[model samples]
Target: MDDPMQTVYVWLDDEGHRTVLLFALAAALGLASVIYFVLTGEGSPTRLQLVLILAAGAVLFYVSLRSTAF
Candidate 1:
């Protein structure tokens, strides 16, 4: 039987590194969002711009989730 509260997969070396990188990227993106909001001061981003940002960030998020590549 396994401990339901603990994730065994995360203990693997590869998964651990990928998880760390994803968390780092997520933290950086969060900071950037904060800065953007602070600087822009509430002007709404255009639909095109929003779509582009989301697409690019999704790619980055996918990359960060990989175990084989950084």
Candidate 2:
């Protein structure tokens, strides 16, 4: 039987690296946005909104880290 975890999936061949990088960049941007909001209090984002943003950032970061093949 083939091990799913061992399966390698490439995204556009060379673009796989870029995809991972993009995800990481997105995560960083999301975190930065949250920090800015918290520090400056310029924008009025509700607690739920902040939590959602943080969750999204975490998910994107995890995806980037786990995207070894793609």
Candidate 1 clashes: the total is 0
Q: Count the backbone clashes (under 3 Å) in each candidate.
A: 0, 0
Question: All models: lDDT?
Answer: 0.62, 0.67
Instruction: Output the lDDT of residue 38, model 1.
Output: 65
Misplaced by over 4 Å in model 2 are 1-13, 43-70
Q: Report the poorest 10 consecutive residues by lDDT, candidate 2.
A: 4-13
lDDT of 1 by residue, 15-55 (tens): 66666666666667656665666687777865544654575
Whose TM-score is greatest here?
Answer: 1
lDDT of candidate model 2 versus the reference: 0.67
**TM-scores across all candidates?**
0.41, 0.41
Give the Cα error of residue 5 in candidate 1, in Å.
35
Q: In model 1, which regions exceed 4 Å deviation? A: 1-13, 46-70
Candidate 2: tens digits of C-alpha lDDT, residues 15-45: 6666666677767767776776788776588
Minimum summed lDDT over a 10-residue window in model 1 is located at 4-13
What's the residue-level lDDT of 18 in candidate 1? 61
